[model samples]
Target: MRNLLPFRSAPAPTSKVAALAAVTAVVAVAAGIASAPVAAEHTDAHAVVRDGQNIRYAGLTVRIPAAGEGVQAAAQSTSGDISLTVTRSAEGKLVVKTDDHEHGDEDHGDEAHADEQAEAQAVTADSARPAAAKTCTDRAYALAGWKLPSFAWYYNPAGAPAAIAGTAASAISAGTNALSTACGQKRLGLVPSYAGQTSAAVQVGAAGNCIGNDGRNVIGWRAGSGRWLGMTCTYFKTINGKKTVTGTDTALNTQYKFFTTTANCNNAYDLQSVVLHERGHSLGLNHVSQSANASAVMTPALSTCSAGKRSLGLGDYQGLAALYGTR
Candidate 1:
């Protein structure tokens, strides 16, 4: 049995790009079981890609016809199980093969011969893989296509009570500014808008339903066309009722929280600093574990709101410019 991890958040958007053709299936049953009547079955399931950007197979439930008591069949299948061994070929395709059969009766010699032939042919057919299977190379390429937008700050006293409007606007603006400077002058840009009575609510630290539910904070498109990018600043809130503030190796879908520090709203998590970090994700940049580079905004774990050197370091610029082509 394969151990499957429970999904904690919404699944990321998968590319609809067509894949290669399906390979033939191959099956091979044990020779000793050739004397008894054999029965077999097959099925297929889609694979799930995770936030950490890992690929996993969805279980394919198979049902085989029962023969008798001790006269049972041993079934073997491939590609459907979530084993690491099952993977895409160099050309990016999924291959599935299986071997299964029950003991056949020696009295039916001619029938047994026919069954063996059929099983052999089935095994050959199953050996080929499917073109639609997910591949690491394709996944990496798709991730490279994701575009990050310039961060923005919006406020609507009519939408949010005046008491918190100024604070929220100031906090978001500072974060956006700090990020732009660190990510590169034009790399991390900012949009201008405000939350209002009709505007979307903003969460901070751990507030709102930012933690557990599948909803994003910043909605709408900065470019005002094509794909709309959402933004979030993690605050306190009940995610499915939990208290977690940040998520890692995951996309910024409806679920999962985007957290920021309390000092950020109070002008502590420097504007340029926080914006640069969050915008990195907006542009599909994953967090880096480089501890030595204090200037790198993609560095894992937010320590302080200082400058972050306030500009897109070499790594950040290379990654973003590569995706969008340094415009």
Candidate 2:
């Protein structure tokens, strides 16, 4: 059940270990399918061709204008309340403009989702920063906990094409498997559910800026801004003085290439790395004490084409231990 699927940062409320149920506001704060021929090798819109192209960054849709021209391209948000425009103001600058009357609030975020996934691909080089790469040692986060003895997740494969939906299903399953291994005999575990596709219009939900609560922990995608790579908006309640995650909506950017194999690394993002970190959030873990362990998957900053994150570091496991209390 292991897939080499492709694909963190810190923010406020990241270090409050006692605040075990800190909402994962965003990935900057901080899936599924289609079977329609994979979109012709992911059109490279870096230079802006005669045709338009796209990629997903945090589920926002950003359409890149073709022919490398200075055209004001208007793209819509997955939430539909926002309209983001991508314009190249400088010779090599990505100027993003948002017409979203309703702005998302501030929250934890990570490596932003892609600007374009299909025909367009525009990432800000400035956005790329030095990330921590550990020597494969143990890491820990601020807090952790899971409500159910074990966790179950369902995916929505309705709108996307067949290939897309199927891959998401398998990749997410693989991601869950990895967590089960990392948790190491803990009562908390991620179990996949074939409950069915999401009844909600969007696979992922968010409040102003917070990952919204709908009890739909989904793995799906859409077109949007390159703000958050993945996010798990959760609902928690203090049960007997302990933070317990009642529900969550685990979501990823469907617009980016969720690499399932090493061969396709050059284009699509790393699906496993991104999804795994989001799962940590769902488990009541906050960012690894902001500005501390970038080497951990829960670290706030992420880089482009960095597949090293797909694997969990030792410190990551330590955090799990803290959250769930030894195997």
Candidate 3:
């Protein structure tokens, strides 16, 4: 079937002719899926895929690369139109590193796989800017070609620490709110409303197999000791040369420790701050250059115990406005 879910609002077409073609494309893709032969495995990282395989996540059908051919990180869709990005954070200066393995890169050749390696760095606030210069002077941002009409997300509180068990969920919701109202005094058009808590956890494996087949957008905690403080796996399909995101899963690494409120925050990372960054990704914003956009929430790095990210910088607001327009 077509990878773009019916629930999503497609970008407005310029003419009735273009609209008709879009519908036809969707039907053709669906028919192809129904008539295609079944593969030995579909989207399962544990199993080895030979000659590649087509796996449906939610309503989107994506092609997985064969083993040794490359990896799932480089897999695409049946029409050769899909990609995945696995983002994670590391210790020290709080860098949120991203690994992009697309389907058609000649080097990888649509080999879809997941990589969870965290790049550690000490990102100081003044790393690139003069100590007294304004942070928003450089309004830099990059879009990932996908923007949800609205964000519907769920939270899993199973692995939350006792100290912030009840409060963490609220903080997560607040992080989403930050993005919805990031542009000036208006909403970012891509409204994000809490969909309540879910028992379904993020489906990433220890080796970073991020197959978002559960269909529900979830945020939760997972116990792990590594440089990765958090991870977000976003799935999307390219239609009309535009990316339409199907869903996203974010998992916070409990092993790294976290503080919910700034009052109790010390050396640990700020829970709300991390969610703000991750939620930015959910809203179609890519990581801006740290050297130029260090103050922006979408910057690739954050320092521990810093609560400044709770607010969106100018570049952050500009990017949101550019994608969804301000409400």
Candidate 4:
């Protein structure tokens, strides 16, 4: 089946298009997920849990299915009892959903309190290690042999309030600027481009995760899954038989209380702080654990309303500078 999904990254070769043809065709065949099902199933609830899992650092539980066959059947999350319907994005980012799955701990009325706990429990995805000036190579999450040096991203407010979308846009722009200044490569910066079309790929009132080849990243709301502020899902493309990463797509949860201003630092999470962390993933950096005493922008996890990470810390810049180089 030929994929009608919008082109995700800058145009690739015919071979790459054919490469997606097989996967997208398989998706069309497996469950026709490109259209994305509206069915809701109740099962276990899941998120970026901290424990022992190889792909855990990336805050994802990955499963590679047979070629020419879609992953919907094989992608359900069995890590726990809850039903987690795993799907794939056009860019191949792993999309996990716990639709209508109610958890014992969910309480939507008090989001600030809920986010406080969620921020503590949920760990963010991968980061980069410093060079000889910082640390040697061979770190676990580091995208060794492959660094996501360049790509363009887009934003789809998805009907968010104008103020909310404006805040988010500013945060994302600040994030890209910080990364560009630190990495010293204008190309590594995540430029905001348009997706040309809108998609409800990520639904509201559920664990909605959407990533587009275009920059139309979505934000949705629901109180039950409020603990998850947002998580990043990276998609990979193999070239010449060697796995190469094309890009990393991110989704932010609207359930959490977000604070855009520097003052009034209540319990809400800072938008720029989270965007900064996820932006690092766009450059192929992994989770580099930071101490509470001196946390970097890539801290594995952060507290509520914490804007300390809005700027680059030593460890954060060290790895970025080493990987992408600085002026």
For lDDT, the strongest prediction is 3
Error of 4 at 78 (Å): 23
lDDT of 1 by residue, 1-327 (tens): 111211211254433332222313211212211122111232223433222222222321111111110000111111110111112222323222211111121121121111211223222211111122211011111011123232233433233223333554454455444433322235423342333222443332111112222233342112111111123322222234222222211112112112233343332223344445555554444433222222344543333224333445655554554454532
Flag the better candidate by lDDT, 1 or 4.
4
Whole-model lDDT values for every prediction: 0.28, 0.41, 0.50, 0.39
- 1-327 per-residue lDDT for model 4 (tens digits): 112222111122111122222222122323322233211221222222212111111123334322321111101111111112233444444333322222223211121111111232234322232233232222222222234535555555564434466566666667656665432323333333434333444322234232233322432322324245555544444455433444445556665566677574566667777777766655544443332212445444556655656655554555555565654
Better of 3 and 4 by lDDT: 3
TM-score per model over all chains: 0.34, 0.51, 0.63, 0.50
Off by over 4 Å in 1: 1-145, 148-171, 177-198, 202-268
Superposition error at 79 for model 1 (Å): 39
Comparing 2 with 4 on TM-score, the higher-scoring candidate is 2
Per-residue CA lDDT of candidate 2, range 172-237, in tens? 666655665442334333343546666564334332123244555565654433445564545454
Using lDDT as the measure, name the better of candidate 1 and candidate 2. Answer: 2
Off by over 4 Å in 4: 1-146, 161-163, 183-226, 240-243
